[model samples]
Target: MPETGDAAPDFTVPLANGDVDSFTLSERLEDEAPVVLAFFPGAFTGVCTDEMCTFQDRLAAFNDLDATVYGVSRDSPFALNEFRNQNGLEFGLLSDYNKDVIADYDIEMDFADLGVYGVAKRSVFVVNGDVEVTYAWVSDDPGVEPDYDEVEAAVEDAA
Candidate 1:
């Protein structure tokens, strides 16, 4: 897991909108705004749905903090589009289908377990524009979700 003060690894991935773009950790923090990068195992799962829905429901609070929220998973763009529409998600859910982002972040799961392969573990990273990781949470149990309050607090502190 990445600790506070460590530089965030920058990467670009395809979005559900079919646009290939890049997001650099340092560039994101340049405006002095914080960013919330939420990593989920996959789209359309019960836990993942609930977790993203939570973000959607509280989108205003996050916006009030002037933070940009990004949901990332190994699911393809098509799957992500369906998930976003079904959940009415307003934020961008990035598609990291190739697992490059996950590998760069070191969040890939073990292939031997549960027959699931090429998936990223549930985690969240709060990064500042300087590419520093202000806060991070990796779910101890893959099925569990991170505490939003904890994340919100971290964002507040970082802000």
Candidate 2:
């Protein structure tokens, strides 16, 4: 997985921005504002819903820090579209259905015991304008949610 201070690998995927479209990480990096990627396992679950709603609530704070947040998962763009609408989310959710972006970041989780594999572990990466990771947090237990304070702090520093 990308460590703090390492250059973040870039990828483009379909965005859940109430439309079927694409967003590129590297493209955002060029704009010189910090970007945040929140990697979740899937959509429409209890914990995932709560976590995303929290982001929805604190979106203004993130914008104030000049950080753009994107929630990511292996779900299809269709599913994420509903997830966004149901949660009233203001940020985009990137569809990593092919599992390439998580693999690139080396954060792919194995859930063989649960009969699933290559799903994303709950994690967050704060990538600065320079394409470097200012903060990284990966959870071993999928049920764990990321610390928003830490994430906000990283974005503040990068901004």
Candidate 3:
């Protein structure tokens, strides 16, 4: 995945916005706002659900830091739409079903042996207003959660 001091790769995907509508990234996500890209293996999986809901619970913290968070996965937009509704997620759930974004970030975890393929590894990247990655964490295990304190500090610093 893109690391700190690296330029964040710009890619737009279908997003299930909190308004219960599908929108393009350019439609709502503020490019100038500090961005938290939360990439996970799948939408409904246990660890993925916890990680996403955790982000939702911390929404105000992100807002206080003037940051916007988006949960990204290779799930279809329709599935993401349902996931957002089911979780009451306040953020966008990006659909990278084509795996283009994951490919670009190079964070794909190989679960082919388990019959999963091209899923994004559990990871987070904090991007500043300049669209440069300020912090990055790619979990060694898919079941592991990210270091929230470190990511929050990065957002604060980038802000």
Candidate 4:
């Protein structure tokens, strides 16, 4: 897993924001804005929905701090688009359908009972314009959520 002060691993993948587009982490870094990557297990689930909605509600505040937020999931781009539309999310979601990003980030989780494997472990990472991780949070329990205030503070400090 990437720790604070470590360089973030970059990846290019499909972004779902009601419309599909290419999203490149390194490219976003080039904009000199702090990037918040929230890795969720799946879409349309109770916890995932609530977590994403919370981020949506906090979108303006993050924007004011010059931070860009992205939700990362193993769902396909089409499903992610539907999830964004249904939740009225303002930020884009990256599709890690191939499961490569989750593996690269070392947050992969397995739900053996559900027969679901290699899903994200519900993580939040803050990477600054320098491509270094400013904050890192990972949860083994999918039921847990990140502390929004702490994440916001990390972005503020990164800025």
- Find the candidate with the highest lDDT and give its number: 4
* Model 2 misplacement above 4 A: none
Regions of candidate 4 where Cα sits further than 4 Å from its true position? none
Cα lDDT tens digits, model 1, 1-159, are: 677888888877766643445555456567746889999998988999999999998889888888878899998877887888888998888888889888888888854657888788899999976678999888757789899999888888877
Query: Residues 1-159, candidate 3, lDDT per residue (tens digit)?
Result: 788899888887877774334544333435546888899999889999999999999889998988889899998888888899999998888888889889989998879789988899999988776677889899869989998888888899988
Error of 3 at 23 (Å): 6.7
lDDT of 4 at 52: 96
Any residue pairs clashing in model 1, and if so which?
A: 29-129
lDDT of 4 by residue, 24-97 (tens): 99998888479999999999999999999999999998999989999999999999999999999989999999
Over 4 Å off in model 1, which ranges? 17-26, 111-114
Q: Which one wins on TM-score?
A: 4
TM-score to true structure, per model: 0.89, 0.96, 0.91, 0.98
Model 2 TM-score? 0.96
Q: Report the lDDT of model 2 for residue 32.
A: 39
